[model samples]
Target: MAMPAAEIEALIRAALPDAEVEITDLAGDGDHYAARVVSESFRGKSLVQRHKLVYEALGGRMGGELHALQLKTEVPN
Candidate 1:
């Protein structure tokens, strides 16, 4: 099962309340996704850390409901 876009968005928002997020279905199968997220909370985090925070929001759904995620993150300027 693939994670729903709304679920993904909600998760991110929960982690970063002021986040700006865009999600794209790469395969249209709901298994693969590309997401761009911008948030103030990412300010001091490294790229790996930023990505980890987003993945953590999924709460262990990565290999289950979620298949793959291509993520891009940026801190607010």
Candidate 2:
């Protein structure tokens, strides 16, 4: 199964309303993606925590509807 990039962005934004999310189709396949997310909510969080937030936003879609993701997280300057 494959998930749409816009749906991924929407899921993340639903969790982090202030997040700036960019989703890329790395292999030109909907199942593989790279995402860069920046949010003020990540300021005090660690790298693992930030990723957890994004993953959580996906609602368990990883390894299922979404096959793979290369993720990067950042806090706003």
Candidate 3:
């Protein structure tokens, strides 16, 4: 089964309640997605760390229910 955009947003929101998140279906397949996240939590984090935070939010689903996620993370300007 593929993951839903709303669910992906929810997962991200749950992990970082103050995040401004946008989830896009990259391939029109529920499994592939792209997410842009802006949050205070990323203030002092590196790109790897930011991506890790998002992957963690998915609870290790990166290679399974959730296929690919191209993510962009930034601290709100």
TM-score of each: 0.95, 0.98, 0.96
lDDT of each: 0.92, 0.96, 0.93
The sequence of per-residue lDDT tens digits that candidate 3 reaches over residues 23-59 is 9998998988999999999999999999999999989
Candidates ranked, most accurate by TM-score first: 2, 3, 1
Q: In candidate 3, how many Å is residue 45 off?
A: 0.8
Model 3 residue runs over 4 Å out of place are: none
lDDT tens digits by residue: candidate 2, 1-77: 88999999999999999999999999987999999999999999999999999999999999999999999999988
Using TM-score as the measure, which candidate wins?
2
How far off is residue 28 in model 3, in Å?
0.9
Model 2: per-residue Cα lDDT at residue 48: 96
Error of 2 at 19 (Å): 0.4
In model 2, pairs of residues that clash are none
RMSD of 3: 0.6
